[model samples]
Target: MPTAAPLAPAATAAARAYLPALTGIRAVAAYMVCLHHFNPFAEGPGLGGFLHNLLLEFHVGVPVFFVLSGFLICLRYYGTEQWTGRWWGRYLRNRVARIYPMFLLLTTLTFAPAWLAHAPDTTRLWLLNVTFLRGFFDAHKYSGIPQGWTLTVEECFYLWAPVAFGLLRRRPRLLWLQPLGLLALGCALVLGLGPLAYEGLFGSFRFMLLYTFFGRAVEFYAGMQLALWYRRGLLRAPRGPRGLYTAAGLGLLLAAVLALVAVRGQYPYGQEAPAGIALNNVALPAGIVLLFAGLLTEATWLRALLASAPLQLLGRSSYVFYLIHFGTIKGWLRDYVTASPAGQFVLLNVLAIGLYYLVEQPLNRLLRAPSAAEPAN
Candidate 1:
């Protein structure tokens, strides 16, 4: 079977051993981001009612992707990491094959129109976006693909995780230092670079805190910690309630959403507030880990729903869905395919699924195929 879109980056691998529910959750996360953009369910401008506010908070799905990345990466590659040149090459190639090709295609498509139209030279913008260097620049982060910025953070984590796992193997006591050090580095970057304002590189405390890996390292770490616990059999399901973790995870998730709504004073998102940042970066990730633990262990109906074959297919296609859900293709879908919002949504999913199977899967397999010097996993 084709490996699903790279979830670590916006998708994850069920390649080593597939988890049906987590695969389904990828569809859920991607769609949540889609709905945050489409927002047809909500009835308001900014945030009208409680339902609207809650839906607005669907942007939290970004953290869901982040957490899934951490969990799946550790689950698959934890003890397998090696310093051998071939092993490292295969690992990095697997990651690149999973994410980069389709991004390259769509990013070029996004800029091609502007270039053809001769609407201000955007060659630099194209370069930054194609390389994902734009993600660090506040001014350019949304220049090509708006949602692609998260990939920068995911890529950072991807590069660091193997080294981190190696270090943790040597000194298990230092696990807590990873995120703390990242947070400190984030602060340092803001203080050192914010005033200089070099193309908004680490421009503001808020941007660094919210957008970059430095600020949101906690989310990924929570997932890694959960995966480690799961691997060690440390996360035991409760005996009494049968659905205790599921219930608790759901409750915490709801509470975090509500808390964000409550603290969203004047700002567009609650995450802008310091308290809101804490809730999203710390509280929300904790909730997601609990939720994932429930999905992994508990035999809840929700898990059954998530693990269903159809949902799994959607999950498999979800990375393409995420990458094209916004920016250029979305506009193209609206213009050429269907102007109606619901129609556009249906068509969007159809196109994403098609691209995943037709374009992405074949290329991924080709890139990941073993060479003369390297062995396949």
Candidate 2:
């Protein structure tokens, strides 16, 4: 067996420090998802439909988040030889603190209007959304802030990551098997179980495979593989004419997106077709990987723009932006702002910034701080 190579000095430094570019890219992903939800384009022939199709396919942003999560988590914690109780406690707490507070607040606020109206099953809807289990049941999947479905998948990844890391560390060979196993499980659920299960259970399975972590494991694995390569000094930004690598990466990514749109078709645009899901489970992740590589490797104009301070701030506040954009403010401003895409974008950013500073940031700091009962090491 070949011994693993050491990371280069730059890669070593990157491993230790915060990757601002990654954060900035996250803002881009969040914005893409936001745009997908808004569908700002007017319907028409030729150019309008083309643009609309492109925006619809931006649902690929969710896979971007998944890949980033897998890469970052693996980069941070992959090589740990032991998983202590204290370590696990801290891990779970950090994950919960990072996600649950704002999620719960926003979810409740989102459902408040429905509850006040006494909509049918509003109580049950609130329960599912607040618990982050809405993704499991088709009926509840779009209950509160429809986008919250992605959080269910994220939570599953958070719970399973450490276990996956431990197993991979012990049996590195399983790296090849793990992703395949997940894909197989997803296929089995969608195919073998779909026909046999009760209606509700089958609906749950369909939603789970389409929206939850199991079907998306391949994308996460792609990211994990990237991290592994990065740690071993096998991955680097391309060193060449700035436009050369950037153009190449962009071309590949565009091709993937076009392929996805073509396979998925235009009408029922965002709905998952059999062919579309199968293609997206592979192609979309490939595009994201290419885009990520280009951003990481090339010193291009795009990189500079993405790494700018304003964008970084947007990225930092993106979680809040995502939570509130489609729910609170969108509903409030729908009539006034929906007609103007630029206006909607600007207002959403402003709202996200306010929410981040007022609630999410402070609460995050407080929760992440070591408890008074826990002695400072």
Best by lDDT: 1
Write down the RMSD of all candidates, one decimal each. Answer: 5.6, 4.5
Worst 10 residues of 2 by lDDT: 368-377
List per-prediction Cα lDDT, in the order shown: 0.84, 0.73
Model 1 worst lDDT run, 10 consecutive residues: 1-10
Q: Evaluate model 1: give its TM-score.
A: 0.92
lDDT of 1 by residue, 184-239 (tens): 99999899988998999999988988999999999988988888887766778888
**Candidate 2 clashing pairs?**
237-297
Best by TM-score: 1
Compute the lDDT of residue 202 as modeled in candidate 2: 28
TM-score of every candidate: 0.92, 0.87
Residue runs of model 1 more than 4 Å from their true location after superposition: 1-15, 41-48, 369-377
What lDDT score is found at residue 338 in candidate 2? Answer: 74
